[model samples]
Target: MDPKEFGEFVTAWCPGCGNFAILKTLKAALAGLDIPPHKLLMVSGIGQAAKTPHYLRCNGFNGLHGRSLPPAQGAKLANGELTVVAVSGDGCSYGEGGNHFLAAMRRNVDITLLAHDNQIYGLTKGQASPTTMQGQVTKAQPLGAPSNPFNPVAVAIAMKVGFVARGFAGDTELLLDLMQQAISHKGFSLVDILQPCVSFNKVNTYAWYKERVYRLGEDHDPRDWSAAMAKAMEFGDRIPTGVLYREEKPDFAARFPYLAHGPLGKQPVDRDALREVMETFA
Candidate 1:
């Protein structure tokens, strides 16, 4: 379970990119959790962050733009033995795949979502993304983004998601700790990472995040809904980086009637009988 044995492909990412830290930490987290490459399934949509699966030596599904969730969920449902993790950028997850994000929360699927919230669309070469702060100018928006940036952590908390957490890419140890917790959680888990896109996003640099980011205090209770909401809504001067909320609930795998006997792949079925039953319905 050596971290070095996880990823094989050479990445074409620029130096000082927060993604490098994220990728390395992710491998470390998996190794620490004793999850081998064959047991992990990484899903992602079209974006710079979506290329994470290409670098990792794991089962990967590079889906269409803004559509990583459907396949990830399907794969997990088919074989509950797999550990599913979806990696996506702010633009791909918050803007393009916003609807899917909401749906995943509603279903409370048994999967982890790692959101690379760098605040800008780095893949498109400096564009104002869904999480981009207001008044931050980009190549696509010379006058700055017109709308206010989306608060994914707050939204997820409001939706009563099973788990909501935040991490900083600049802190490798913190990121690894959060990822391990997210993947180990039984129900849906969301970890919104504050990544610094050095090339495209100049505003939110490594130093910029280090100044504002602070960890949640020991007294803070993640189970307290109101308290967690307060922690999630904190922005501007000081930002909290830690678990916001977590509550156990019935996961999709348990609720699905078809999976009552366990994963579909693990159950023995009579294909002829199933086909005959389907023909009767037709």
Candidate 2:
């Protein structure tokens, strides 16, 4: 399959937005895996990053603000055959949807989360997001942000999320590989992608990330929790990108007794059983 087979629609993003590279890389990754558009399900919440699903020629669901993961999990549970991806911005994933994000890792659902970490809330203009550095001045905080930055990679690794990785939008080849690996992983996966909000954020531009971001060396072990935690904490001058941690474990659907037979969507409904339960309530 060709990347162009996924097709594309006119996007509302800024011309130089990092999302454009991410979108292109995602298409290439899916094409590389030979996943047809029909087999993939893209879920997103309200934000500039949430607009990703709208541009893809695949099954998509645009849910409420910060509610992308729940529906993505649900879709995966119902039809295990679908390749589910939940896309969100830093604000949507780490601020408004913080609780859901925690729950998703705990559940270990068979889905991949693509977090567009632009560090600023672009959809609402230049506002400091959860990942925004402490004391960073934004339109929302002229006096500078009061709180410390949230480290999502660290949090995910600490939670022992099945797969934890980071990607940079400026590097398409690396991003594509990370995307494919995250998707193919047996359990829940996170690819926290560093992106530049061209119209909103000025500090962390393509050039800035290019200088700081570096791939993990072959000596680094992704399965070692301690090593992964250390790598996750490395930020500022030299940021480490690539698979930080991974562990083999049973996914949420795998543990369910009913799913042992088949996925819920593929199973035939037992009308008699349903009628008996309803009659008892009646």
- Using TM-score, give the best candidate's number: 2
Which residue pairs in candidate 1 collide?
none
Q: In the order shown, what is each candidate's alpha-carbon RMSD?
A: 1.4, 1.0
- Runs of candidate 2 with Cα error greater than 4 angstroms are 279-282
- Please write out the lDDT profile of model 1 over residues 50-151, one tens digit for every residue: 999999999999998788888888888989999999999999998999999999999887999999899999888999998999999888899988998899
TM-scores, one per candidate: 0.96, 0.98
TM-score of 1: 0.96
- lDDT for each candidate structure: 0.91, 0.95
Cα lDDT tens digits for candidate 2, 1-282: 999988879999999999999999999999999999999999999999999999999999999988999999999999999999999999999999999999999999999999999999999999999999999888889998899899999999999999999999988889999999999999899999999999989888899999999999999999999999999999999999999999999999778889887879999999999999999988
